[model samples]
Target: AAGVIQSPRHLIKEKRETATLKCYPIPRHDTVYWYQQGPGQDPQFLISFYEKMQSDKGSIPDRFSAQQFSDYHSELNMSSLELGDSALYFCASSVGGGGETQYFGPGTRLLVL
Candidate 1:
């Protein structure tokens, strides 16, 4: 399976501006996850959506929002992006079941100025 896909491989946003990223999960997968990877730091989980509901928030701000549609595609919207928001955003997907493995996308690199 292709697993997942994300758009805008890279982006640059001004301080306090808004940005949107997209993600597409493979068919038959019901869970979609998002993560943020900072320079020289481990990837931190942002949120997870299963059955159209948010499952968890690992380490994300209220300004960072996400949605999963009926088609299983998801989008992450960052409002008032700051310089500290500059990082790599990754999308992943897994079956909502035991031992499910999350397969990640290429990631969107955002450089907030």
Candidate 2:
């Protein structure tokens, strides 16, 4: 089984800038998971997209948004990024419409300057 793939493995942004992080889930996986890990912090669940619809959300800031495309790939759109937004953004994929034994992609290390 192939692992998840994330683009632009590293990112740097200025305060109030916008960034888009993309995720390519494993083929045939219907569930996508998004997580954020700040410096020295445990990964926090951000959101989930199932069947191209937003299925769940957790602690996602107002300035952050996400979506899943028809192709099953997902993207996180962040606007007005704050310094606190500097974190590693990870995405995972599972077989069904929820988290369970997911395969994680190497995160996008975002640094909000």
Candidate 3:
């Protein structure tokens, strides 16, 4: 199957701007993998939604939120963005559940100016 797909692979926004990132999981996958990698840090597990419900919580800030739709895709909505929000946002999909094996997509690079 094809890998997860994230839109607008590269995004440039100013501080306080809002951005919506769409993630299309692999066909029939039931989980949305949301993680972020900052300037020199390892990938951090932000959160995940399984079967349209939040599966686990992480360090996601109040300004950021996410959702999984009936169709199995998800969206990471970032509002009141800050310069520190700049990072590579990644999405992945798994067949069974949140703890199952995951196939990651080419990440979305967000730059806040």
Candidate 4:
């Protein structure tokens, strides 16, 4: 049983820098989502892609962007790093359409100094 995989389990950055996080969804899963969780805060949906197309957008900042690939993996691009941006970035995957049950990855912990 495979699950979503995210690279660079942890990251460190300075304010004003940029970082790119990678995600590999479960096989056959067509939907990939990105979420950001600040300390003691609930996970916030950032963006999602279905079948390689942008499907939904949430509180993602203008300085951030994401995309799903042909293989169903996804990437989150973050820029203008700020201390407030430090958090756990999670990647979740689901099969079929939106509303389907999703499974999340371990998450990438980003720290801005």
lDDT: worst 10-residue window of model 1:
93-102
Q: Which residue ranges in model 3 land beyond 4 Å of their true spot?
A: none
TM-score: which is higher, 1 or 3? 3
Of 1 and 2, the candidate ahead on TM-score is 2
Compared with the true structure, what per-residue lDDT tens digits does model 1 show for residues 22-108?
Answer: 999878888899999999999999998987788877888999899989888899999998899999999998888331688899999
lDDT of 3 by residue, 5-111 (tens): 99979999999999999899988889988999998999898889989999988999999999999898899999999999999999988976635688898999999
Candidate 2 lDDT over residue span 1-113, tens digit each = 58999988999999999999999999999889999999999999999999999999999998989999999999999999999999999999998885578899999999999
- Tell me the deviation in Å of residue 62 in model 4: 0.2
Return the clash pairs for model 4, or none.
none
Q: After superposition, how far is residue 40 of candidate 4 from its true place, in Å?
A: 0.5
Q: Rate the local accuracy (lDDT) of all candidates.
A: 0.89, 0.94, 0.91, 0.94
Segments in model 1 whose C-alpha atoms lie over 4 Å from true places = 97-99
TM-scores of all predicted structures? 0.94, 0.97, 0.95, 0.97
For residues 3-81, could you state the per-residue lDDT of candidate 4 as single tens digits? Answer: 8899989999999999999999988999999999999999999999999999999999999988888998999999998
Error of 3 at 83 (Å): 0.5
Q: How far is candidate 2 from the true structure (C-alpha RMSD, Å)?
A: 0.9
